[model samples]
Target chain A: MMRGKYVIAGIGHTAFGSLPGRSTISLNVEAVRNALADAGVEKDIVDAVLVKYPTSHFESIYGQKVAEALGLTPRINCVVDQAGASNIGMIGYAAMAIEHGQCEVALVSFADNPKTGSRAVFSRSRDPNAVFGWFGVPAGYAMVARRHMGEYGTTHAQLGAVAVACRRHGAQNLRAQLKKALTIEEYLEQPMMVAPFRRDDCCLVSDGGAAVVVMSRERARQLKVRAPVPILGFGQGHTAWDVAQRPDMTTTMAKASAATAFKMAGLLPKDIDVAQIYDCFTITALMTLEDYGFCKKGEGGHFVEGGGIEFGGRLPMNTAGGLLSETGMPGLQLVLEGVRQMRGEAVLQVPHARTSIVSNQGGVMHTHATLILGQP
Target chain B: MTDDEKAAALRPPADPLGDQFWQSLKEGRLTFQRCKHCGNAWLPVRSECPRCLEADWAWENASGAARLISWVVYHRAFHEAFADRVPYTVAVVELTEGPRMTSNIIGAGDPEALKIDQALRLVIEPDFGLFVPRFTPV
Candidate 1:
C-alpha cells in the first residue's frame, strides 16, 4: 500500500474539439502552462514530464521531443505507452518517481490531433492477426459485444444506457466534443458501424490536450498548494498485445488492475464516491464496470440500465461525458475530471464527493489502469 | 479482385516464422505449428511455443474442420483498403486441431444467420493473385 504521499496538485484541460490551428506540441504547451498556473508552481520546479507515446512519430524520439519542447530537462523523463491506460499509468509512475527520490514535481500530460491530422493511431505492426482480417477497434469491439451478448444476454439497449448517460454528462461541459444529449431512441436509431455497434455507441474523434501536475505530499505542503488531490493508489494490468489472442473476450485486465488498486488503497468498490471510467465505446464502459467489480461479471449491461450510471444514480460514472461524449483525446482527461471531482471543481460535480476512482482501458481492450484518488 | 485485394490476400507480412504457415495455406492446407518438444499447437505462427518457450517447432496440417467463436459484419470501413468490401464478414474460428484464426466465413448467405460453435470447413480462395484461406459452413 502507498503512504498516500503523492498529490495531483493541479489539473488542466483545453477545449476538447476540432481546432486545426493547434499542433500536438502547442496544445500540450497550453495544457502544461495552465497546469503550472493551477499549481502555483513555476515551470522551472518541474523536474520531470511524462506523456503518452506518440504513435504519429515514425521514430522513437517521442519522449525526447516532448520533454525538450516543455523544457522539462531532467535525469528522469520518458513516454508511458500503455495506450488508453497511459494516463493513469503515468500518474502511478510519477508517484513512484517521487517515492524513489528521482524528481520532486512531475508534469503528466497528453495531446493529440487525430481528427484534423492523420488518424494513424491503429495497429501498424502488420502482424499475422492484422493482415488476417482484423478490421480495427470497432470491429474488434463489435466481436466482443456479440460474445457478451451470447454469453450474458447483454443487449443493445443496455449498451445504449451508457451512451445516453455520457451524452447527458457531456451536455453540461463546455469543453466536451459532442454536447447534444442522446436518447435511447437516437442511440438505437443510429446507423450501424458494425453489427452490435451503432455510430452513436462509439466515441467521437477530436483534437485536444490535458495535463496534471503530480508531486509528493511533502512537496505540495512545502509549496503550500491548494486542495491537493492525493493519489491513494493505482494499479495496471494487461491481457494481450494482440487483440485476437485474448483468453476471454468479455473480461479485460481491468479486473486485476482494480483488485490491486483497491488493495493498495485499502479501499473497496463501494468506497468510491464517483467514477470516471473510460468510455471509448459504450460496450467498453459496460465491460469495465463489470471488470472493476462495480457489478457482477456479465451484469454490466444491466448495471447501467435505468439511469444507473447517470447523474444522481447510485454510482455516477464518466461524469465528464467520457471519450464517448468528451473529446477523444485519450484517457488522461478522465484523470483530470476525477481530480476536479476531488477538488469539488468538476463541471458535473458529484455532490460532496470525497473519494473517486478513474479507470482507463487501452489498446484493443488490451491494457487497463485503475487509480483511487481522494482529498488529503 | 482488385490489386489491393490481391495484395491483401497475400501471406501476411513477410516473416520467417509465418512463412511456413502461409505457404501451407497457399498449398491448400491449413497448418499450425506444434512444439517439437511439447505438442502445444498455436495459430498465427509464433516463433516459439508459449507453453515451453521452445523455439523448435514443426508445421502440422489441420483436418480443415473448425467452429465459429465470433464474427462481425462491417457496415463501415475503417480502412480505405477494405472500403470496397464493405459489409464483408470476418470471423474468428477455432480449428478442430486447437488453433484459432481470423478469416472470412463464406457460404453463410446472411451474416446474421451464422451461429456460434457452428461447424465450418476450410476454403482456399484466390484474392487478386494471392491465395487466402476462408471458411464455409459445413
Candidate 2:
C-alpha cells in the first residue's frame, strides 16, 4: 500500500461563476493567496508547487505559467496532467512530496476561463481517427444514461430529482453560479441539450479557480489551521479516451477505482458523510453513485429519488453546489467543496461532517479519479 | 458546410499513419490488420506492430465477419448532431482475429434482437456517410 503522512493544511475556492475580467493567471493567484492565508503559513515556507492545466487553451506551460503569476517561479515546480483528474491527482502528488520531506509545503491549484474562448459541449469535434466521428462528449454520456433508463426502468423524473437536489443545494450557496432554486417541474421543462439531459441537467461553463495547500501533519499543527483534513486515499483508472473504443457505456472503470479507494481508506460508501460526485451531467452523478457503490447496480436512479442526497437526507452532497450549478472550471471546485465540508464551512454542511468523498471523470466517461478526505 | 462537404471534411486527409485505414473503408473492404514484420494477423490497426514496432504495414481484405460480445442501446442522443438518431445500438464485436473492435450494430435496434455471440457481417453505409463499419446479423 502507498504510505503518506501528509495533511491538507488549508483549502480555498474562488466564487464559482463567470468572472470575465479575471484572467486565468489572475484566478490562479487569487486562489493561491486565499489558500496560503487559510493555511496560516508564510509564503516563504512553501517549498514547491504543483499546477494542473488541461490544455494550452487555458495555459501554455502550467508550472511556469502559474509560478510566474504566484511569484513562486523560482521554487521547485512541476505540472501534472491526467486529463480531468489533474486536480485530484495533484493532491496525491502534493501529499507524497510533503511525506517524502522533499517539500515542507506544497501548493496545488487549477483554473480555467472557458469564456475567453467559446468552449462548449457542441463546439468540440471528434479525434482524427473519426471512429467516434458520430458523437461528442455529450453523446457518449447520453448513451449511458439512455441504457441505464432502459435497463432499470428509470424515469426522466428520477434524473430530474438529481438535478433538483443539486439546484436546491446550489441555491443556498452564494458562490454558486446557478443559485436560483430549480424545480423538478422546471428541470423537466428545460430545453434538452442532448436527449435525456435537459439544460439544467448539464453543468454550466464558468471562469474560476481552486486551490489547496498540503503539508506534514506536524506542520499543520504548528500552522494551527482550522480542523486539518487528512487525505485518506486516492484512486485513478482509465479504460479508453474515445467513445467509439469503449466496450460498455453502462458501466465505468470508476467502479474499480472506487473499490480500490475504499479498500485503501478502510471506508465504505455508507461511511461517507458528504459526497461531491462530479455532476457534468445529471446522469453522470447518478451513474457514479452506482459505480462508487453508494447504491446497488441499476438502483442509482431509485436511490436519488429516495432523497438520499438532499440537505436533510442520509448523505449531504455537493453542499456548495456541484459542477451542475457551480462554476464548471473542470471539477476543481468539487475538491474545494469536499474540503469545505471537511472544514465545516459548507452552506448545507452535514452535522459534524468529518469525512467526505470527491470524484472526477475526465475526457468523457473514460477516465475516473476519486479522493477521500477525513478530519482526524 | 453542406452534408457532402462536411462528410468530405470529416474524412481524414491523407496521412502516413492512418490514411490507408480510411482509404480501405471507402473501397468497402473490411481490412485486417497484419504485423509489419512477423506477418501475423491482428484485429485493430495500430501505429506500430506489437510484434516488432515496425511502422511499415500493409492493409489486407478480411471476410468481414465478427461476433457480438456486448451491446448498449442509446435511446437519447447526447449531442445536437446525433439528436436525429435518438436511439442507436453500439457494440463491441469480436473479429475472427484476437482484437475486438467497437461499432454500431444496426438492422433491429431492440436489445433482445442483438444477442451476445451472434454472428454478424460488416455492412457499409455509403450515403449516411462516415464509412460506418456497422454490423448486420449474418
Each candidate: RMSD: 1.9, 4.1
Model 2: how far residue A362 lies from native, Å: 0.8
User: Runs in model 1 with CA error above 4 Å?
Assistant: A56-59, A123-126, A129-133, B4-11
Stretches of model 2 off by over 4 angstroms after superposition: A1-4, A54-59, A120-122, A129-135, A150-153, B2-4, B34-44, B49-122, B127-138
lDDT of 1: 0.83
Q: Tell me which residue pairs clash in candidate 1.
A: B6-B128
For residues B1-138, write the lDDT of model 2, one tens digit per residue.
456665665565556546666668888876867776778665456777766778777767777788776555545553354445656666667677645666777786455455566898889776436566778888
lDDT of each: 0.83, 0.73
Interface RMSD of 1: 2.4
DockQ of 2: 0.25
